[model samples]
Target chain A: MSSPARRGRPGYDQDAVLQIAVEAFNLHGYEATSMGLLAEKLGVSKSAIYHHVASKEALLELALEQALGGLEALLTEPAALEGPADSRLEHVLRGTIGVLVDKLPYVTLLLRLRGNTEMEREALRRRRDFDREVSSLVEAAQSAGSLRSDVDARIAERLLFGTINSIVEWYRPEGPLSAEELADQVIAMVFNGLHAQS
Target chain B: MSSPARRGRPGYDQDAVLQIAVEAFNLHGYEATSMGLLAEKLGVSKSAIYHHVASKEALLELALEQALGGLEALLTEPAALEGPADSRLEHVLRGTIGVLVDKLPYVTLLLRLRGNTEMEREALRRRRDFDREVSSLVEAAQSAGSLRSDVDARIAERLLFGTINSIVEWYRPEGPLSAEELADQVIAMVFNGLHAQS
Candidate 1:
């Protein structure tokens, strides 16, 4: 709507439109936001905006898919996929943390989606699949008597994954530590005790 | 908004109204949903809606207040607040997990807020306070020589809270494990090794 005041750029550019959409969704939330608001923010006509992305839901899907893809790649890395159980688990955990940090905004939005729409539900499904794979590693480690058996594999899986997923809450790359350093710190804390093991 | 339509007693009661609002907020998001939709779904006038709560923000505040109060209560419980350091730490962890299970919906929403609004920022501050208390417990446990010292207290604190906060992602109470049982399992997995302790 505010595009009326603009003089020259009459068309929507896909990448620029997506950047605006990401900010809008991040600031106001996907469901609360409107197409008119998005168009105004991007300084483009509604139809011009539509020309780049079919619908708002499509934009959500695009962002979510990329975030999930980063996660999936980390899970499937040869190091994460195959190694001595401890080594493999560490790789996966560190890689996952790295993904969350690098793709903070996108992953933050993805994590916030609670399956309200078809796209969100699908995102949830893919996420579960990824979790399922990670749980198998937890189980394998448990069966090997490497992990403590007192906790069930499922609960361990949830706690470990939960901790990794929480990074998006405060992890800002520009703030202090690099994503790599943060990942290393996370692995050390989760694997080693706060007090030096005597 | 729709209260006049249901002037008859076929109208919803207070619990019904709260549930409808929760569902709408959960689906469309808290910020996007309006009292008008809530009234429409309840088949009541906005005046009838006012009979229950002052405004949409009030409903949100009420919901979050209950969830955060549960957490604060857990921290103050004699078991969680006292005893040898490790025992107290364990008590807080188990109690917080139980609280999360009991108030899953509200806590989940609270965890996802990004502080865009004054209410959200206050909620976040309350959350940090909880984290600070938990971190103190971890520090005490380390000082008491119960926890290992290989990791820094701050990093350990993040992992501890992150693990607990992650619970909302997949902890379905309807699933096989009861909340207490899940807590037990979490403690074991976190404290024990995936590998046989060397």
Candidate 2:
């Protein structure tokens, strides 16, 4: 399938290559997928792929960056940075859900990383930093008496994001549940008890 | 390391073999772990490992059963069956936490299944059935005016258990948070929400 004509196609840019590579990585697992497999899936030669990236790990780095970059950007946005801790936390939660929905495959890949490589370890470190940032926000909300102080901030952070992260397991972009609707339901359940108010 | 003396040891049994195999499966992807690797890990010949399980798929079946059995048992427990729907749901949630904590490795394996084979397909089906059962309870609670009716019952069930299932990603038996403590925090956050009531 390594035709020069196919490799020279106008639409087969680096972004297109990355999208397909990430999908392949998510399907077969990063550790199991080889460049040959990716080349075969892309209907291109290994050289065609290498023309865009240096190695398989580069594809992973780009994918992780795509997922992490979206999340990190949320922490610094006007609403997230300027609001009351509770509101800011809410914004972050909603924003994170948006990121997960928008970059479902990339985020799914990020979540499944096992830290078997230096690149993965670095990604994990960034992820932990992101968690710590959210945990700090939770602590701020608790101190402000917006969020319940009884639950440890770290544990609260874990449960909140854990529930959010689990969406990648079952969510489909084409499914009836829109991203905004999902954010609304999650926000409602999280900020207000599910118990019917008397 | 395939010493006959090691194979003859009283401590080496099917349970022991299954335990190590599950651990290996969790560390390495299940498809990547071969029986030869399992034999090496068990310090026995392939034939000695075979004496306990017929094949690698058999080991996977046994491991999945260990995990699924724990979760399935919770559905039939009196607390899970005999209370108001919300209370019954809480009991199942707490019980699930206990099972996850007790069978962390096995459950981790079960959660990561990709359904590449019939055995995995059956396990996935059972998992869906378990999820459906929980969703029905959520629907019952909503009808009983205990759970908020606005949110979709199925979505609530997913978030509740998704948060629960995520514990395997980070919970450690030796960590400061005990299973009971973890369950309390989860139950508190899930049913009560994180917002501090004035």
Candidate 3:
């Protein structure tokens, strides 16, 4: 059985709280996890959490904001934005998947967050916006004849993200594959076909 | 606002207690959702639940067993097992996706279930078995040169299932797409390329 996650860095220590939040949210789920539980997980009182954030909702908002912001940053990266559309799309895909894997708990919590709270709703909206940016890249790639031309872009977008997002269900950082290894494998599978080479 | 997910049917005599079980299980999550709250949700006493299932774990076991049975049955069908690997794989994919969509609530709960309780672990064991069956089909498809052969069969299996598994995040049954429509779209995206032909 996997041991509980180790805490993150000490100074600028929202990282510890974020890690604990991600774990608690993932284990019990966001709706069921409470700020008090988070504080307990981090070996602190609930009031100490407030010294850093205003409310449980604020913590959630901050966590999702980081997760979404990482993805959005990938959109603006030099390699992701330039080059042939397929290569650029591939670049963005690899970068985003890498970010998701590295920040697995945070992104998992982010992806699983439904609009139960105002913070969640905002996160959901930002997620959709990220999706649209990726979709635009897919459109560009399709126009360039790199991606296949028979299926609808919207459906393709959903499948691509769906495949990428499902990584959370089975991905364990402690497993044989490192985060980078897993991301590379996903990218190779998504872009190049998975059949054995002749 | 979700129409309160009405309990019972016009003529089918749907069990109200089951509806409460499903909602509570979905909302609080099965591990955290309790008998007292379930009783409260159903507007019934806790004894009413015991009258139906032996315990909370029993309720979970029944639900997952039913859902997994539906999925396993599809995998063994002649169409899913025979034909060109792509066609058979597509048949399996479409059937599985359809089942997942038709049984969203049950399957969603099934997918999110961690091996917390004995019943949950059994459900997980069955899920792994189901995954293995599908992976065999993927392996067969690769051997037949129907699927790309560049990626490892195991990882490829993960991708195929991952893509299918992601439906939980976005699909809305009450939305415009019928289950069959969604299934077709999902199948096409995974198997047939998505770029529009010039």
Best candidate per lDDT, number?
2
What's the candidate order when arranged by decreasing DockQ?
2, 1, 3
Arrange candidates, best lDDT first. Answer: 2, 1, 3
Error of 1 at A33 (Å): 5.4
Docking class of 2: medium
Candidate 2 lDDT (Cα, whole model)?
Answer: 0.90
Q: Residue A23 error for model 3, in Å?
A: 3.4
Per-model CA lDDT versus the true structure? 0.77, 0.90, 0.75
Clashing pairs in 2: none
Best by TM-score: 2
Off by over 4 Å in 3: A1-12, A28-55, A143-145, A178-181, A192-198, B1-24, B31-59, B83-86, B178-181, B192-198
- Give the C-alpha miss distance for residue A164 in model 2, angstroms: 0.6
Encode model 2's per-residue lDDT on B31-143: one tens digit a residue.
88999998887777788888898999999999999889899999999988997999999988898899999999999998889898998999999988988989999999999
Tens-place lDDT digits, model 2, residues A1-198: 346566545557889889999999998789789999988878877998898999999999999999999999999999989979999999999999999999999999999898989989999999999999999999999999999998999999999988999999888999999999999999888888688877
The DockQ scores of all candidates, in the order shown, are: 0.42, 0.80, 0.40
Of candidates 3 and 1, the better by DockQ? 1
Q: Pick the candidate with the highest DockQ.
A: 2
**True-vs-predicted CA distance for residue B150, candidate 3, Å:** 2.6
